[model samples]
Target: SCHPECNGICAQNMDSTSCTDPQTQYCSPYEYNSTSQSCNFEPTCVDNCDLCYNTIECQDCSPGYYLTPSKLCSETCPTGYYPNGEVCEKCHSDCSECTGPSDSDCTACVDPKRTPVSGICECSEGYFENSGV
Candidate 1:
């Protein structure tokens, strides 16, 4: 039976046997409860229960990444930073790829004394187009 109509009972006529609200009432796009014994509303589950940037809910990790229950969904580490303890981490500004903590995964084009923009080595001495250290 429809809600508030048959008082939640289906009559022998295959109808609510009483007044029941028809599905056309609200015109919902889709109802998870179509064949429901009674007229009750239900909710649908979405992926991952949580959402993250650059990541799809209930999905696998991208390359160079791993999945962990403690991790935020679809979370990504910035370039040069590796995944560590549910976050991305990088080595020293000088070393590449975990040579040591605080060391960079790749050497800087310019010294740390200079300002940085876009991870491209810029001139502290004031120059550009740096190939490597």
Candidate 2:
């Protein structure tokens, strides 16, 4: 008889109903037959094993600061700011220190002592302060 059978159905010819496994949902184990009641196999998820996006990068932490678990860029301590290794920290007033990202690392004057109102960016560690005309 032309009944919806597991072994074969009229799907191709316009009479067979689509057959699939109840668990996996894949086509029945065997092709649609005349009188089968069960599909033999199940469908499964195939891991693509995708890779990370190229845009994402692992930048280094800013100076005076340490990298966190979530690899992100951070600013370093400035003249006044002091990071406790983990993060940049604010220095006491009057103390001139530097802070900010390594790229634009900041170095500002704290309280107590006044910053050279004029050309204060004159001295470095090893070099003496340059007196510009």
Candidate 3:
């Protein structure tokens, strides 16, 4: 019997159910358990992780955290980090997103009220910006 929630096809085994596509690795909010050889229904991600597989291994992270190339979730990225499609990246101090590490390399401001000024962004007149908001 195949799983009802599986997006792709699922193969039913005498011991358990497994997803046929290895590349997709999807099982409708669940992962195939090789240990018991079944589809795991319980959640088992580390702190700050929203989706997990292989027990403690994270497939997706909570907000403010990003999934790394190594499959770990981190609040910040390693040096020389660049965007890799919803992956972790370190932006310039004054930028939400940037082309380079320098403050003047900012491509966008973190705050909507602020405008880019000489590579950095600051609040326009009559507006104030604060950090760690």
Q: Pick the candidate with the highest lDDT.
A: 3
Q: Regarding lDDT, does 2 or 3 come out ahead?
A: 3
lDDT of all predictions, in order shown?
A: 0.37, 0.35, 0.62
What TM-score does prediction 1 earn?
A: 0.23
What does the lDDT come to for candidate 1?
0.37
Please estimate how well model 3 matches the true structure, expressed as its whole-model Cα lDDT. 0.62
Per-residue CA lDDT of candidate 1, range 1-133, in tens? 1222333333332234443434434311112133654324432213332322122222244444534444433355444445665444554564333422442234442255544334433456655545788
Shift in Å, residue 104, candidate 3: 7.7
Model 2 per-residue lDDT tens digits across residues 45-111: 1122111111132223424434333333344333455556564455444346644333233344433
Candidate 1: where is the Cα deviation over 4 Å? 1-50, 53-79, 104-133
Clashes of 3: 1
Compared with the true structure, the alpha-carbon lDDT of candidate 2 equals 0.35
Reference-based TM-score, model 2: 0.22
Give a tens-digit lDDT track for model 3, residues 33-133.
65664666766666777876445566788888877766678876654354555585666767876766677766678777887787687787788856766
TM-score of each: 0.23, 0.22, 0.40
